[model samples]
Target: MSARMQVRLWLWQRISAALLAPLVLIHLGTIIYAVHAGLSAAAILGRLHGNLWFGGFYALFVLACAVHAPIGVAKMAEEWLGWRGARVTSLAAVFALLLLAGGLRAVYGVVLS
Candidate 1:
């Protein structure tokens, strides 16, 4: 990647990290509270389903994950797998697709089911 691209990716990763922090905390806190309260799957699903705010939050969370993971993986591959340039870019693209697919699937299960 060029210097400009690297800077952009770094900025994006930082932004995504900032977005993820609160979402992750909220998710973890909800899970812990729900488990402590003995909330059933159906009860949790009830809160998630038909809730636009929750849906939007999960969507944003998924998008951030999609952006964050590939960039991190690209750096990992460069260090560990000796990948760079086009190869790293292609791998990151595949990683992004997989992240999007899995993340959105989770969001759908949470929000739609």
Candidate 2:
């Protein structure tokens, strides 16, 4: 990859990390609240169902994750695993696709269906 592309990916990873930090906190807090409130599965689903805001939030979260994890993994591979060049990037691409596919499916099930 070109140096410019690598820099772009680095910037994206940082941006995504910044976005995800607050989101993760909110997500965990919500989980805690739901568990404390003894919210049943049906109740949780009811809350999420047809909620555009919830869907959008999760979609953003998933997108950020898709962008973030692969870059981090690629960096890890380069640093710790002594892997680099196309192989590392190819694996990151695959990981990103899997994350997107699964995360979007989950978003569909919980918020759209």
Candidate 3:
């Protein structure tokens, strides 16, 4: 990638990580509360289904993950695997797509089911 593109990617990764930190905390907290309450799948689904706030939260979370993970992976490939150039970009694109599709699928299953 070009120097400018690399800088943009780095900035985006940082921004996405900042966004994800709180969302992940909230997610984990919700899981802990659900487990503590012994909430059934149906009960959890009841809370999520048709809730716009939950849907939005999860959608943003998924988007952040899609953006964040690929950048990290690309960096790792460059640093650890000694891979670079078009190959890394191609892999990152595929990884981002997979994350987006799977995460959105999960959001749909839980929030829109």
Candidate 4:
């Protein structure tokens, strides 16, 4: 990758991490609250359905994860596996797309179904 591109990726990774920190805490807290309240999956979905704010929050969470994970994976591949160049970058991009698709699908199901 070009130096500028690498810098951009680094910036994005940090930005996504910043977004994720509080998101993850909120997500975990929600999970704990759900379990403590003995809420079933259906019950949770019932509350989430048609709730735009909840859906938007989770969508942002998914987006941050999509951006965050592949950058780390690409870096790991470079460091640990000694991989580089377009192929590694392409694979990382593919992984990010998959995360986005799957995560957003789940969010859609919960929020719209």
Best by TM-score: 4
lDDT of 1 by residue, 1-113 (tens): 78999999999999999999999999899899999999999998887888878888888989999999899999999999898789999999999999899988888888876
TM-score for each predicted model, relative to the true structure: 0.91, 0.92, 0.94, 0.94
RMSD list, candidates in order: 1.3, 1.2, 1.1, 1.0
**CA lDDT of 29 in candidate 3?**
100
Candidate 1: Cα lDDT at 49: 89
Model 2 C-alpha lDDT per residue in residues 1-100, reported as the tens digit of each score: 6899889998999999999999999999999999999999999999999999999999999999999999999989889999978899898999999999
True-structure lDDT of candidate 1: 0.91
On the 0 to 100 scale, the lDDT of residue 57 in model 4 is 96
**Which stretch of 10 consecutive residues in model 4 shows the poorest summed lDDT?**
82-91
The regions of model 4 sitting more than 4 angstroms off are none
Candidate 2 residue runs with Cα over 4 Å from true position: none
* Worst-scoring 10-residue span by lDDT in model 2: 77-86
How would you order the candidates by TM-score, starting with the best?
A: 4, 3, 2, 1
Clashing pairs in 2: none
- Model 4 superposed RMSD (Cα): 1.0
Give candidate 3 regions above 4 Å deviation.
Answer: none
**How do the residues 1-113 of candidate 4 rate in per-residue lDDT, one tens digit apiece?**
79999999999999999999999999999999999999998898899999999999999999999999999999999999989998789889999999999999999998987
